[model samples]
Structures are given as structure tokens and as C-alpha cells.
Target: MHDNLIVIDGLQYSNWNRAIFEQLKSGGVTMVHVTIVYHEQIRETLLRIGQWNRLFELHHDLIMPVKSTADIYLAKKLGKVGIMFGAQNCSAIEDDIAMIEIMRELNLMIMQLTYNNQSLLACGCYEAVDSGVTRFGRQVIKEMNRVGMIVDMSHSGERSTLDAIEISQRPIVISHANPSSFHAAKRNKSDEVLKALGESGGLLGFSLYPFHLKNGPDCTLDEFCDMVANTADLMGIDHIGIGTDLCQEQPISILQWMRNGRWSKEMDYGEGSKSDADWPKPLSWFKDSRDFPNITQGLQARGFHDEEVAKIMGLNWLNFLDQGLQAQKV
Candidate 1:
């Protein structure tokens, strides 16, 4: 992997600290969209941002906030990792369309309408019936578009996902998920959705989450790379990138929070087996921020041209963010 290539992870939520920051630097990761909230409401979401502020101060040398494409370049120039905020669910905005602008001002650039369950905005993939985007979701999407906040549907149901792509004037995204043809996990998207996403000029960031991979933790680099290649043939090469969904160093209890939150008293296993409550093992080739070069090498071995590999590794995401984070012109 060339150190000059702008490597960006489209989505990640790690137990961040100096060690992870250093690993990201060593891996040549210029920018990352970090998940700021899943189920937290407005106040708790603000607290999460406050915690990130503290992290920025504490790790000033290794990481910095990314508010624009200019900041991505600045991170490269200064040899620091650029961090951008995102929410995996719309709970942070909590039924208010105005809050979309507020969150954007605070630099929450991407938000999913649902997170494995029905929400005020849309239906999640886990729902038996997908009611699609609600009237409120349409209003929120417009507000998000105007404010330059991205509508991400990685966890949304198919109808809702398609509806978002059609209704939003600007392109939306699926920041982290795999094709259902590769793996049938509820979190994985379908070919129909991928086709609609590409046709609408949106992007899909392939997930490295175990449940979404073809064979869970045992999936080979070849299998993963081949899947990317196949998906590119289905979608356009420009519409695909890496969103590893890396939940590094998080405890098993955190998984409970992600899957259940406050909605259920009973435990939810999510994609894991009912008895398995632990994080599935990551692929041997790409386990952490430091292992990113392995993916570049895998792409190269799979015969991707240097330019195509570069785009998949990061440049495409940079372009997407550049467009998605800027307020719409009148």
C-alpha cells in the first residue's frame, strides 16, 4: 500500500485510545467515520460528542476532527488520523427535523434511519413488515440534505432503503453492510438494494463484520476480495468502498447495548448464535487498523488496477464525503 493514498474507513466504532490511534496512523488511515451513537437520545448523544472532544484533546498528536475534505488533506499533511462523527441510528435527533441541522453543526455527518428495529423515521431489516420511510423520515431527509448530513441506511429495511434513495435529492449511503447474496444475515443488504443504490449514485461500504461475511470468522481474504469484485460488477466500481464495521476491543456487554438498547428486557444475540454472546473472530488478514495493508495486497492479488484499488481503499469515500458533507446549492 502506498503511504500517499488517502485510506479511510467509512465506518468504525472502537474502544478508542492512543494505541488504536497510533495503529491507524501506522496503517496509513487518513480518515475514519466514527460511530457516535446508536440508541442514545439527544442529551446522551451530546455527551458522546463531549467524550470525543476529550479524546481529541487527550490524543491531539495522533488524531484530529475532520469537518471537511480540507481536514482530510490536513490530516495527511500532519500525519494524524482524521476522525468524523456519525450515528448508526436517528435517535440522536429524536423526532425533531430541526435537530438534523443542529447535529450537522456539531459535525455529525452521517445518520441511519433505523438500527435493526422500527424507528420513527423508517423500518429496520429485522422487522417482518417494512413500512418504508415515514412522513417524518421524508422531512428529516430533506433537512439532512439541506444541512449536508448524510442519510445512511445500512440497518434499514429494503423498502425504506429504496425509498430513501428515491426521495433524497442528494445521494445517500449504506455505510457498513455486505451483499445478502454473499451472506444472508439480516444486516446484509440485497442485490436489488445495491442496484438501486448504485443507480442513484450512492455508495455502499462493504462490511467486515463476521456475520455479514460468507463464512463468518473463517472467511478467507480471497473470498472477501472476490465478493468485492463481484459486487463491483453488480454496482459500479465507484460506488463501493471499505466500511470494516470494526468494533475493536469492545466488551461483550457493549454488544448487548447495540442489539437490545432499552427496547428489550430480554437479551438479543443479533447475528451471533443464540448461545454465543462474544465478538466473532476477525479475519486473520485484516484484524485491526494496523492490518489495512493486507486488504490492499488482497485487492492487488485479485487483479485490481492500482487506481481502482486506490479508489476502493479510500479515494472514493473522500469524494463521497466531499459531496455529502457540503450543503446543497440552491
Candidate 2:
């Protein structure tokens, strides 16, 4: 892997610390969209932003906040990792359309309409029947488009994801998920959704979460690379990138929080497996952020040309965000 190549992780939710920042720097990761909230309400989401601000203050030399694509370049030039905030669910804005631009101003650049259940915006992948985009969801998407906050449907259902693509003038993203054909996990997308995404100029970031992989943690680099190749043929090279979904060094409580949130009285194993009570074993090939280069090398070995490998590694993400992150011209 070339050190000069720009690498951007489309999504990650690691336990933030100086060490993780150091790992990203060592991996030559130029930028990452870090998950700031899954179920946090407006106040709690603000607190999360405040917490990240503190992390920035403490590790200013190793990491910096990325408010734009320009910051990504600056981070790479300075050898620091750029951290951009994302919300894994719509809870951050919490029923208020106006909060979209406000959160964007606070640097929450990406947000999903749903996590794994119905939300005010859209139906989740786990739902029995998808309602598609709600009235509130339509308004929110428009506001998000105006303000440049990305609409993510990584955990949303098929109808809802397709609805979002059709409704939004700007291209949305699936920040982290795989194709259901590759693995039948509820979190993965179908070929129909992938094709629509490619047609609408949307991007899909491949997930590395164990459950989303074909064989979970034991999935080999070759297997993973093959999946990428297959997806590229389905969605085209420009619409795919790495969004490893790496949740490193988090405690069990956090997993419980992500899965259950506040709605469940009983434990809700998101994938309906009791074994999901604990984090699935991490992939052996990708133990941490420092292993990002392994993905680039795997793509190369899987017969991706240098340019295509660069696209899958990070260039696709950067180019997609270049337009999507900008406020719509009225």
C-alpha cells in the first residue's frame, strides 16, 4: 500500500482516546466519519459533540475536526487524522426538522434515517413492513439537502432506502453495510437497492462488522475482497468505499445501549440472535485502524487496478463527499 494514497473510513464508532487516534495516524487514514450517536436525543447529542471537542483539544497534534473536504487534505498534509461526526440514527435531531442544519453546523455531517427499527424518518431493516419515507422524513431530507448533511440508510429497509434516493435531489449514502446476496444478514442491502443506489449516483460503503460478513469473523481477506469486486460490478466502482464499522475497545454496556436503546423493556438482539448480546469476534485480518492497509493490499491482489484500488480504498469516498457535503444551491 502506498503511503501517499488518501484513506477515509466512511464510518467507525470506536472508543475515543489518544491511542485510537494514534492508530489511525499509523494507518495513514486521512479522515474518518466517527459515529457520535445512535440513540442520543438532542441534549445528549450536544454533549457528545462537546466530548469530541474535548478530544480535539487534548489530541490536537494527532487529530483534528474535519468540517469539510478541505480539512481532510489538511489532515493528510499534517499527518493527523481528521475526525468528522456522524449519527448512526435520527435520534440526534429528535423530531425537529430545524435541528438538521443546527447539527450540521456543529459538525455532525452524516446521519441515518433509522437504526434497526421504525423511526420518525423511515422504517428500519428489522421492521415487518417498511413504511418508506414519512412526511417528516421528506421534510428532513429536504432540509438535510439544503444544509449539506448526508442522509445515510445503512440500517434502513429497502423501500425506505429507495424512497430516500428518489426523494433527495442530492445523492445519499449507505455508510456501512454489505449486499444481502453476499450475506443474508438483515443489515445488508438487496441487489435492487444496490442497483438503484448506483443509478442515482449514491455511494455504498462496505461494512466490516462481523455479522455483515459472509462468514462473520472468520471471513478471509480473499473472501472479503471478492465481495467487494462483486459489488463493484453491481454498483460500479465510483459508488463503493470502505466503511469498516469497526467498534473497537467498547464495553458490553455500549453494545447493550446500541441494541436496546431506550425503547426496549427487554433486551433486543438486533439480528434476533441471543448470541448478539456480546460483540461478535473481530475479524482477524482487521484488528484495528492500523490494519487499513491490508484492505488496499487485498484489493490489489484481487485484480483491482491501481486507480480502482485507490477508489475502493478512499478516493471514491472523498469525491462523493466533495459534492454531497456542499449545501445545495437554491
lDDT (C-alpha, whole model) for all candidates: 0.93, 0.93
TM-score, each model?
0.99, 0.99
RMSD (Å) per prediction: 0.8, 0.9
> lDDT for model 1, on a 0 to 1 scale?
0.93
Per-residue lDDT tens digits for candidate 1, residues 155-231, read 99999999999999999999999999998888988899999999988999988888889879889999999999999
163-186: candidate 2 lDDT, tens digit per residue: 999999999999999999999988
Whole-model lDDT, model 2: 0.93
